[model samples]
Structure formats: C-alpha cells, structure tokens
Target: MDKFVTRSRAPVEEQEVELGNLPADPGLRIPISDYHPNLKDKVRRAYLQKGACQPSHNFKKRKIENLLRRFNLNWFNEYKLWLEYSVEKEAAFCLYCYLFKSDNKQSGDAFVKEGFDAWNKKERLDLHVGGPNSGHNQARRKCEDLMKQNQHIDVTLNRHSEQIKNEYRIRLGASVDCLRFLLRQGIALRGHDESDGSINQGNFLEILKFLAAHNKEIDGVVGKNAPGNLKISSPDIQHDIVNASAVETLNYIIHDLGDDLFAILIDESRDISVKEQMIVILRYVDKRGHVIERFIGIAHVPNTNAASLKVCIDSLFAKHGLSISRIRGQGYDGASNMRGEFNGLKSLIMRENESAHYIHCFAHQLQLTLVAIAKNNVHVGSLFNMIANLVNVVGASCKRRDILRDRQAIHIYEALAIGELASGHGLNQETTLKRAGDTRWGSHYGTLLSLINMFESVIDVLDTIVDDGPSSEQRAEASALLEFVQSFDFVYSLHLMKNVLGITNELSISLQRKDQDIVNAMKLVKLSKLRIQMLRDDGWDDLLAEVSMFCEKFNIICPNMEDNFQMKGRSRRKVHQVTNIHYYKVEFFYGVLDMQLQELNTRFNESNMELLLCMSCLSPNDAFAAFDKKKLIRLAQFYPNDFSSVELMMLGNQLGTYIFDMRSDNEFLILNGIAVLAEKLVQTKKDMVYPLIYLLIKLALILPVSTASVERAFSAMKIVKSRLRNRMGDQLLNDSLVTYIEKAVFDGVLNESIIQRFQHMKNRRGQL
Candidate 1:
C-alpha cells in the first residue's frame, strides 16, 4: 500500500490537550474508495439485486437486522440509521442516542435486493420494488450518502488551506529578504518606468498594480468581476507589508540605539478637514555616538489642547516601550497653551519629571520677537498696515488678482530673456503676493521684493486700472497705494526689514551647519551684529525725525512716547550684569524721571528733592513744560480733548474724595517696605522663584499662551496628510505623526511604572 504515514506507528499517548495547543495523533490513513469499506459493496449488491437493470445480474434480499449484523452495527429505527455496535451505547439509546448520533452512525436503512436475478423484464420490475427496505428508506440513504461525500470534500479543502498558508508565509519571508537585499546593495525602493533602464516582476509598481486589480497575484483575473487588464498592487495588503517592514526597521534601530538619553521633537497639526494630528521625531545617540534624527511616526489627538496632546504623546511612548523620564529637552512653537508654566502642557509634563527641560523653539521665538517689535512701534505698525491694505485691495478682486499674476509671469519671462536665472545664493523666487485687509499685515517682504523686481508689468497694469472709471473706494484706495509706492521710506524700509530678517535666517542655518560652515557663519553673525549697531547709532535719530515729520505732514497725532517702569518687576534681577545694567538706566529715564516722579511730588510731597532732580533730567530744555498751558486750556475749552475724557472724570472724582492722613501715609510706606521684604524673602527661594521666573518669561515672551501653536501644527499637518486619508481615526493618525515634531523626550522613558500602567489599560480594553 502506498500509505504516506504510520509505517511504524508508536502507541500514541492520549494526553489531555491544552487550549490553543493542537492534539498530537497519527493521522488517519483511510483508503480513498473505502472510507466506509462495506458501504460500497452493499450498494453494489443492492444495485445488482435491482438487477439486470443495467445488464448485470445478481440478487439478494435481507432483513434490516441481518444487514446490520453484516455491517457489525446495531439498528435504531428512531435514528433511521444502523449505528455501529458499541458497548458505550448499550442502554436506553433508542430515542436519546438517535438525537446525538455521530456522523458515522447517522444513517438510514441499508440497500437490499428486491428481486432474484433473471433474464426477464418482470424480474427488473420486481427489483424496482423494495425487498426488505422501503422506497422512502432507499431515497433517505441516498441523501445521507451525498452528505458523506460532501464531508470528504470539506476535509480535502481544509488540508489545501493549510498548505496555502504555509506557502504564503514562505513567500512573505522571501519578499522581505529580497527587500533587505536591495537595501543592502544601496538600491533605493523607488519606482521607475521600463524606459528608465530597468524592468522587473519584483518592481513595486508592477506588484502593486497587479495586486490592486486582481487582489491575488497568481492566475489572471480570478473572478468574473476582476478586470481584464488590471494594474496596481492591493493597497490593503501592501499597507500590511509596509507596516510590518516599518516595525521591523524600528526594532532594528531600537536595538542599535541601546541605552542612551535621547530627546524627542514633537509637533502636531491638522489636515484640511481640520483633524488634529501629531508627528514625532527622535534625536538620539547611536552606538557610534553620532546624534541621529529619525522620523518615528505621525499621530492624531482628540483636540489641539495641551492635555489632549499629552495623552496622545503618552500613548505613543507606551506603544514604543519608551522611557519619558530620560528625555533631556523639549522644543515647540510659541503657544501659551503648550508652554504655560501653570497648567500648560509643558508644566504638566515637567511636574512628573524635572529632567525634561523646555526650550523655546529658536526660530519661532525670533519670529515672535520681530512681530512684537513691529506691532509695538506705531510708525512701523502703520507701515505694515498700509502694505497689508495694498495687498488686499489688489488681490481681493479676481480680475485684479489675475492681472497681477500675469504681470508677475511676464516679468519672470523678461528676466529669463535677459539671461537672469533664479539664484540660490540669496533670495530667489518670491512667494506669491496675497491680499491683506486694513487689519492684516502686508505680503511677506520676500514676496514684495520679488514683485518689485518684476515691477514694470505690474506698474503698467496699475496704470490701466487707474485710468479706468474705478469705484470711489477703489480710486481712493489706489491713490493711497500710489502714494505709498512713491514714498522713499516705504521703499527703503521694505528692503531694510527684509535684509534684517534675511540675516536672521542666515544665522539660523549657519548655527546648524557643518563645523567649518558654522564657524564661517558665526563670523558673518558678528559682522551682522556690528552692522545692526551701526544702523542704530547712525540712523535711529534720523528715522525718528523722519517719523515725526511724516506724522506732522499727515496731521496725525504722534502716539505717546512715555514708558512705564515697575520696581517690582523681575527684570530688576537681570540688571546686575554689566551688559544688562543699562536696563536700570533706561527704566529710570523712561519711567521714574519721565512722569511718575513729577506726579508723585505734586500729589504727595510738593517739595520732594527726588522729584525735582528727576523733572530736571526729564526736560533739560523744558520743551514739555514750556508748552503753553493756557493755549492747551483754550484748546480744551474750544473742543473735546482726551484730558476731559470719561476716564479722567472718574480719576478726578476719586482724588477729590480721598482723605490723606499721616497714619495712612506711614502705612503705605510700610507696605512699600513689605514689598521690598518680599523680594528679599524670595532671594533664598531660588529653587522656586528662579525656575518660576524662567518659566514665566518663557511663556510670556518666547511662547504664545494661545492656541496659535496648535493652529500652526495643524497647518503643517494639512500638507503632510491630505485628502487621501483626511478622516484618519485619532489613534492611527497620532501614531503616524509622532515623527514630525520630534518631541525631545519620550515621557515613558523616565518612569517604568507609567509604561506598565499604560500597558495595563491597553490590556483591559482588549479584553472588552
């Protein structure tokens, strides 16, 4: 016999099988045609007895009991099957046993000869009629036989499925090995057309296309619905392959990284549909001590707040088995919600572990500083506002916007015609000009400069628009725009500010460049600083004079130049350093000597010596006090003045009602002394005060305590994750984004307990 197994079958130990563990047994080796050996013979005999029906002769008649005895089985009329005789079923098994009969025992009556074999038609007719078995019983047996045949088919199918699974595993392994081989050979996995010098069955393009259309790679168009010519691999399956590959790559990297304190750079953003997402990046030391930055993943948060963001970050760390405590640094945009000391995301994280220090994102901080300076000064702010309005008026209308765009294109072409190419040495192509309203800032300087360089066409277009019968608002807007365009300040200031920002950008790149490059950049920074100082020394007074003249020419009031100083401010601590010592002088000159001292003397002590000294310095020329008080009074009498405003009315009334007493005065001085004492008390609490101040400055100046950081993060996210998966779920998207921001620390890295806690939560959820 050509049997495949059990040549030397050892008596198998019938041990109890554990759950998820398969039972060990020698597989059955039943013959193909004789799975039920006697059944075939009985059917053949019955057919012969029905006899001579197919020109073959044989005949037999047997009782159901005799048939059962022949088959070594017992008859159960209730079951309609002759069950195999077993000692286990010897008692009360008629009705009960029939209901629970095994597949082998679930059968009907056996076939028997209906007539004797003869060479006559009568004998055949008699064969058709039942001998021992009824016609219904024979039909039932046929149905049972068919069911047995189907069961055999199912067994074969299951065996084939196992074989397919084994084959698939082999193929997957081979594919992975091939990919690794290519990576080792320095061959990138990018796709190329056949015309690009290579063609292959293993090409990602070919595999992907093939799988997408047919689902399976083998046997073209396996189903009727399958396309005749399909392309692209199955996306779902491809994603699985990619996911597994990514995990494997990550595992290898983790193993190589070993135990080293690492920082993470994390940033979160939203896609077009406004889904909040995050990206994580790793800054870690490799085995060779090289600082490496590898993109880890992108993730999603439920919301763009610090708390929600922290949870997403925490989950990512736990999933990756990271320790957050070891994180040594953090870098994020200036968002108050992100960096706030009291209940901000950074504060919450620091509370758990102190080592994860927060650092202002240098680039972001510089941008905020520039913005603040621009907004704080009235002249500078007005210039930007005018520029912004100009962009808005020009770009608001589709027709005008098109004209501008066309003008830009023509200018670009002309420049190219003149043998000028976009250069990388400095600023090249500018961003497109975008419209801004009265409240908005103008186009970025880079964009404006590019537009100016391409000015000929733009000027022509503007002339055409002006010549047309424009609306009154448009005409007035256009005239104001033309005035700004012609102004020397407008032209010079644009270039000047652009140059300043350019230096800052250069400094940023220089600081991060290669060693030699960084050294050269540092030299450039020094030169730039000198240039800035020279501008301040030489041009500040001139600029201020010009600003005053401009304001006078426009009949606009010059905004108050007075500065306020508070002695209790933490900036006092910084004044101890020589470089910073000038701050105290500035405070005294702008604050104490400017307004407060004179006011204090008039209100409290009329003959105060400190007040007189401060007033003398405040106006050496006495130009302010020399202003005709009677003329100011006459002007106030003639028209509405700020001094007569409702605010002063309340203050004057309050002053009239005040009762000044020596005890009250003494108490006020004592309060001042107490405030001084408070400062003294805090000197020794450096651990608390210094860090708190550091955090406060960082939050107030370096970061915005607004949702702007989260907003910016989402804006970046829109670029990274688009319509392809605009609606990715929170958890999946969050995982994907962890790599983008490059969070400085993995929160779980610092605490084992936290990670375990996370794992426990995950397990509990999985059970549900």
Candidate 2:
C-alpha cells in the first residue's frame, strides 16, 4: 500500500527527482522521485483499471458484488461502496416499478430477449469504455435478469392488504345498496330477498362474524392452517368500522323522521348457547298514521338487572345523540326486573324522565294469566303433570322414542291412504314448551294440549313398554300412567287448553295484524281478559268438583263432605255475602284468584277496565304516587277504588292548566295533550283515545328512550364488511355509512353538519 501510494502521490514543487536520481544519504533517500509526473499518472491509471467500474444501477451493483465475492478482492471495497449508493437509489426506483410500473409479461419478455443477448455478448469493457453505452447496458441487463427470476413475488407481500380492502368494498357496497333498495321499495326485512340470488344466502352470519370480531380471525371462521397465499384480514378493524357505522346510520334514520314519536319494544331471551340478549324494536307512525315496526338491534348483556339494562340502554342513546327527555313510554314483559314498581327498569327510566311509563307486554301478560288459572285448578294442574310425566318417560329412552315415532308414522300413512289429513298428525317438529319462572308456573293448558295431540304415539309407546319390556315394577308404573291418561281430569283439561289456546292465538293474530280495526283490536284484547277471568272461575269450580269425585273414588278424605261444615266467623276483609263460608276456603279461593290475575296480566293483553278493576279489587285503598297534576286529579276520583264526577272535573281543570301553559309551537305539547286525553278516557271509557293515544305515547318513548337506532346501522355495516375484506381505514368506513343513512331528508334538514360534528369530535379525540 505504501509503495503504490508513494508512486502515485502528486509531485510537490520541491521534489522533482526521478527514480534513477535519488539522493545517497539514507535520511535524504526519499523515494519522492518515484512520484514524478509520468509515474504518478501511471499509478492513477493502474488504480482506476484494477478497482473495476462502478455501475449507476441497482442490478449492476448486485452483479458486481457477486463477481467481487467470487474473486475475493478486498482492494475494490471503497469502489464497491460507491456503487452501493447508486444501487440504493435505483432500488427505490425498482420498488416503484414493482408497485406501479412493471408488467409481469413484459418483464418476463425482457428476460427472454435481453438476457440471451447479454449472456452471449459478454465482454469486459476496455479502459477506454467510458462512454455512457457501456455502463447503461450493464445496468439494464442486470435489471432484466432480476425481473425474470422473481416475476410476481415482489408484489405478493402487499396482496393480502389489497384483497382485504377489496373484500370490504364489495361487502359494504352490497349491504348499503341492498338496504337502500329495500328502504326505497318499502320492503320488510323478512321479505327483502334479492332477485337473482339472495344476498344473505347463509353468509349473513359470516359477514356479521367479521364485524363482531373486527377484522380478526375469529374462532370458527377460518382454520389455523390457512395458506400463506390466502389473504384475509383480521376482523378487528371491521368490527370497529361497523360499530361506528351502525351508530351513524341510526342517527340518520332518527333525523329523517321529525316531530314523530317512536315506540320501543324490548324482549329478552337466552339464545341457543345460553347467551342472554335483549332485542330492541322500534315502532313509529308514518305520515299515514300507520304503525311500522323495525328491529333495531340485539344487544348482549351481562345480566337482565334493571339498573344494568338501563345503563346499556342509556349508553346506546347517548352514542346516537338521542335524549331520554323525549321518551314518552316504555314497553316490557312482566319480568320483575323490568316492571317492579320500586326498582324495575321502567321505574329507573321514569326517575330520569317522568313520562317513560311502563306497560306489561299485552300478549305475554295474557299468556301468564291463562297459565295461572290452569295451575290454580287442581284437576287441570294434575292432569297436565301426568301428561308431562308420560312425555318425559316415552321421550327418555331411544326405544320408547322409536316406538312413538313408528306409531306417528303409521298414523300419518293411514290417514294419507284414507284421503284424510290426520287431525292430530305432524307432532315431531320442534316445540317451545311453556317455561315456568319465579312468579308463575308453566301453562298447564299448553302442556295439556300438546300431550293430547301426541296421545296416540304416547299411548302406543307405553303399551309396548308395559307388554314387551322392563320389570314388573315398570309394568305397574305403566298401568298407573295408562290410568292417568284415561282419567276424566286429563280429558277435560286437554279440551280446555285447546279451546283457550285457540282464543289466545287468535288474539295474538289480531294484535300483530297491521290493518285490524281499532275497535276490533280493543274487543280482542278485552275478550282475552274475559277469557282468563272465566278460566279462573271455571278452574276453581272444576277443581272442587273433580277433587271431591277423586276422593270418593280413592276412599280418601271427602273434600265435599268437609266443605259441608262452614266456619261461623269469616275474615273481616271479605264481603259478607254468606257467613256460612269457610274462612280457609275464602282465603284459598282469593289466593288462587290473585295469583291467576297476576299471571294473566303478564301473559296477555287486558282491557283497561279489567286491569284497573283487578288493581282496585286487590288494593282497594292502596296509595298510588301522583307526580303530575293530571294524575293527582285522576287519582283523587279513584281515592276509594271508584271514579267520581268530582274527580273528573278536577282532572279537567288540571288539563286546562296544562293546555293554557303549553306552547303552540311545541311538538311535545301535542303529546302532552294526548296524555291528558288518555286520563280522560279512563273515566269516559271512550276507548277510542286510549288505543291511539297509547300507541302515540309508545312511539314517543321508543324513539328517544334508547339508542337502539344504531343497531340497524351495525347490521348494515356487517353486511358491508365480511371475512374476505375486513380491514378498512376507520375514516373511510365511517364515511360510507354516514352517506348511506343521510339520504333521507327532513323538511330540508341535511345531516352534513351532524356528520361533520362527529368527524371533528373523532379527530380531536384521536389527537388527545
């Protein structure tokens, strides 16, 4: 290194000695003469030639690096580094080519064509090969070779990301478009089927899975061994997008319908996997005064406590900018948590906003009342228990089950051959038996009816078991079962439930029908109440008669004979129609009555008169809280369990005060007036104002009570983003949903400002 450096060092003016003219003194024997002008020029040329040419392209740098490695030359290391700088710059360009420039077919063609030429004409350029052609050709040939070796692999890494976006676009696009079409066409959800192929075609849940898990590879979706070539995004991003989208969409729907109160219907049930979910539905009046019910969402809750449920409800509302102050009423089943006057959900909501009154689900209340009445009747209850036990026994063993199945098949075939549809065939489908809870037992009537329809199969199975299988004890039990099935109690209860079920079912149909007349609707509701009352009366009478007959048959205590002895003193609370009645019997009868009424109120719709009368009868002088002036006046008349003209006049005066103070422009005033009108109806029994007014109040509460409006939007979002494309930028996903929802206009009120507010809030929060 010193010899070469000394020879190539530029000549200093003081040192003009050539190699042959060196001084003799060892200290002065400087080899500066070797650094003469001609020798220096020669050294420079040698260095340049030996180090190798630095190419201007990335491919060439790689090519040179390979060649250098093969030769194991460290001398050209500095020169090689300079080439690396050029390689880096070109590498950026190559990346650009892979992203947006290179065509795979063309890249391959370049390899097939230029590669052969470069290989066949390979030559090291002479020292004079300083022309641009020499360096450019080397770089170009290197690029061609590199492209040939890796045709599409360079772009494959980004494929998954691209595919995810595309999938999101397609799914979201389909969902939005389908929803818009349906909304415009006014199609119901159940009837909203696509023309050529149904959009939801079993993939509806799959799409929801994507949104729920939010771009994540949720369990049960894709297997762990998914190929590297397959590109599916995690559903986490999708979930977030859908959640936000759902809220936005719901807001838009709410905004579109102005000055209209909505009604909320919430029902809670455990799903197949025992996950408790509350389904929220909204009912509102269109311009035509017709009611429309739209399912908003199904929300999973930790528990069904009123406080927790209310919190869930409130959070949903706040998210969508709905104010609870606008709520007018609440509808819930007769579950204690939902309807308990002290700490129930309705009471909690009412505490926040006084108008959010609760109504037991009319249908559910009717069902409850029927079940109670059936249970209170000893004959009916026992009959049902026997049938239920028989079903359990037969259904318990596969052999018995098979026997029942075979009997059913035989019955059906026989009926078909005789050209008659069996009146009691087709019983092998899924059935929802009435479930018992804290307040009430199962509907004995429904169970009785179910058993009767399956009686043939049940009897055949029991006969087989008694004749062909099991021990003597089993035979004896089977004999008892046969006796129970044949008992008059069983036959009577079976006919009773069938008739009651028919009535209840018809009542349900009337309530659910959109075009049923208001008068007819009220009549049906009223008749349902009467049916329950009549059943309760019949249950007691039948129980007494049947029990007495059974006692006589079994040689047990004669209930009828005991009833012949009457108590001298009765409870003071009893209306003394006859002092001969037994105190225990009156208490027992009243107990049964109260239980039946409570159950009936929960299971079916009841007339206002029946409801109030029952309440009056139970708590004749019980104090009811009166917050509003109208309620106070209304309560004043019913102070002693009956309405009076003086109280009606007082209520009228209260309404006058409310109306006098209410603003003409306030839409809420219209609703307030309706509430006053409802108060009047309780006295007048006009019935006209009650149904419509109740409906109006229901609508008002549902709209602003909870943010269930956001539910549909989320469903739409899930439809838009599925497993195939889950990852989407949050902003983009939100934008797509907002646009879809804000299509409807309300008195020229556009949602642009609202959307902007949402975005601005999001941006500000993101920075923080």
Number of the top candidate by TM-score?
2
Worst 10 residues of 2 by lDDT: 617-626
Provide the lDDT at 308 for model 1.
74
User: What is the alpha-carbon lDDT for the whole of candidate 2?
Assistant: 0.42
Error of 1 at 190 (Å): 19
Residue-level lDDT tens digits of model 2 in 1-768:
011212243454433422212211111112323344444333222222222222211122224434421211231242241111111122211111111112233333221111211211223212212355433334344344433322335334333455454443434333333333433232222213322245653233334334435544333232232333321222322233333344445544554444355445665654333555565555555443444545444555768888878765654443232445445446665678977888988778777666444555544555556554656666556655666667666776777767777787786677667876645555335332232232222244455555655666667777887897578877887878977766544554555556555557667645544322223333466776686567656655655565455445434343233344343235655645443124323544445455655655544343234323222211101121112444334333422212257645644564444433333324323332222333333444433333432332223223222222333444445543334334433333433434443334211322333323222221111110
TM-score of each: 0.44, 0.45
Clashes of each: 65, 38
Error of 2 at 27 (Å): 91
Q: What residue runs in model 1 are displaced by over 4 Å at the alpha carbon?
A: 1-157, 160-207, 210-239, 396-402, 405-445, 469-476, 511-531, 538-716, 731-768
Candidate 1: C-alpha lDDT:
0.38
